[model samples]
Target: MFSYNVNEEIQLRLLELRHTDELFALTDGNREQLRQWLPWVDGTVDTEHTKRFIQSTLAAFAGNNGIQAGIFYKGNMAGCVGLHGIDWGNRKTSIGYWLGAEYQGHGIMTNACGTLVNYVFSELNLNRVEIRAAEFNTRSRAIPERLGFVQEGKIRQAEWLADRYVDHIVYGMLREDWSMNGQASNRFEVETDE
Candidate 1:
C-alpha cells in the first residue's frame, strides 16, 4: 500500500481492487475525452475490466517491475500516473499518465508526475526516466517540459489512438540531470506506506 501526499490537495496511492468502482465511473464519465488519447479507453467497458487492470498493477508492484497509482484530488479519484515497466538491467523506465477532463488545468498531473520522477531518481535509484506524449498533445507534453525533461526524440506512428496513428515525442530526465537541476529536492511533503 504505497501512498504519497503530493500536497494538501493531491495524493497518489497504489491502485487496489477496492478502487474498481470509482475508477470505472471516472473512466466511463470521461470516456469520450479519454478515448482521444488513450487507446485502452474503449476496452475498459466495465468495472470488471477496470478490476483486471488494477489487478495487473498490483501484480506489477509485487513483482518490483513498476507501479500504477491513482491520483486523488480533494479526496476523490481524479486520474492515474504510472511507470510502464522498469528495465532494471538498464536502470531506466517510462512514465504514463492521464487526468479526467474535469481535472485538467489544475496542475495535478504535473505535480503527480514530478513526484514519480523524484521517486525514480531517488527512491528507485534509476538512472533515467522517460515520458512519451503524442506529438500533438501539448498538455501531455507540457508535464515533462515543466519538470525540465529534455526533448529526446520522436517516433513516428508510435501509437494507434482510435482510428489513426499518432507520432510520439519522447522526453527524458536522467538522474544526474535531475540532481543538478535542484528540483530534485522534494517540493511537497511526501508520505509513503508500503
Candidate 2:
C-alpha cells in the first residue's frame, strides 16, 4: 500500500474497493461543485462505478503504470491525488488531483502535491512532472503555481465537461528545476515502505 503521512492533519492512502461507499459518498455530495471542472461527475453515479475505478487504480499499480490515492484529512475522506499516467520512455508523468468542496482553503492539495512531486522526482527519478489545470479554474491552477511550476502553454479545448470544452494551462517542472528550486521538499513521512 502507498500511504503518505503528510502531517497530523492530512494523509494519503491507496484507494481500495472497500472504500467505494465512502468515496462515492464524497463524490455524490460534491457532485455540483465537482461537475463544474470534472468531466466524469455524472458518470460516477454509484458505488459500483467508484469500485471499478478503484479496481483500475489497483491494476495500474500492479502493472507499474501509476497510482491514485484517497486523500484523508484527520482520517476522513477528502479527495484524491496521483499520477494520471507515466510515460516511462520519456520519464515523465502528469499529476492530477481534486479536493472535496468542504476541504477548500485548508491548503490540503498544495501540501499533498508537494509530497507527490517529491516522491516522483526524488524517489522515482522521473524527468518531468506536469500539472495541467483548466484555464478558468484559478483554485486548481494555484497548486502548481505556488509550488513553482513553469507555465508551459495552453491546450485549447483540452477537456469536455458536462456542457462545454475547457482549455488547460499546462505547468511543468523538470528534474533539474526541482533540484535547483527546491520545489517540494517539506517533510512527508511514509507510513509504509515503498
Candidate 3:
C-alpha cells in the first residue's frame, strides 16, 4: 500500500473499502468529466457497486495483479489512479489515471503521476512502465511529455470505446531514464502485490 502527503493542501491516498463511499461520490460527481476516458462511467455508480469494485481491486492486488488508489486533494477525494494489467514476469506495468475537471490544469495530475512513477521505479523495481492514451487527448498526452516518457509509437485502432475504435499513443519510461533524469521522488514503494 502507498501513502503520501503532498504539501499541506493535498495527498495521495491508497484505496480501501473503507473509502468506497467517498470514491463513489467523487466518481459520480466527475462522471461526465471522466466519461471520455473511462468506460465504466457509462452506467450508474452507487456505494454498493463501488464498494464491490474496490473489493475486486483489493483482491487483484492480493493476487499480485493490480492496484488502485484514490487521489485526494485537501482531504477530499478528487479522482483515481491505478496500475493494472500488470505483467510481473516481464517486469512491466501500465498506469491509468483521471482527475475531476475541477482539479485539472492545477499540476495535480503531474504531481500524482511523478509520485507514482517514482514508486514504480524505485520501490517496485519495475524495468519499464507505459501509458496509453487516446491520440487526441492532449491533456493526457502532455503527462508523458512532462514526465520525460518517450512516445514510443501509436497503436492504430487499439481500443474500442463508446461504439468506436480509437488510436492509442503509447508512451514509456524506464528506470534507467528516470534515474538519469533524477525525477524519482523518494516516497512509497509501488506495491504490485498491493
All models: lDDT? 0.90, 0.88, 0.80
The 10-residue segment with the lowest total lDDT in model 2: 185-194
lDDT of 2 by residue, 1-194 (tens): 79998788999899988889999999999999989998888999988999999999999988888989999999899999999888999999999999998888778888898888988987788999999999999989988888889999999999998889999999999989887886656743323111
Pairs that collide in candidate 3 are none
**In model 2, where do residues sit more than 4 Å from their true spots?**
187-194
What is the TM-score of candidate 3?
A: 0.90
Identify the superior model by TM-score, candidate 1 or candidate 2.
1
Best of the candidates, lDDT: 1
33-91 in candidate 1: lDDT tens per residue? 88988999999999999999999999999999999999999999999999999999999
> Global CA lDDT of candidate 2, please?
0.88
Error (Å) of candidate 3 at residue 190 is 22
* Candidate 3 Cα misplacement greater than 4 A, ranges: 185-194
TM-scores of all predicted structures: 0.95, 0.94, 0.90
Stretches of candidate 1 above 4 Å error? 187-194
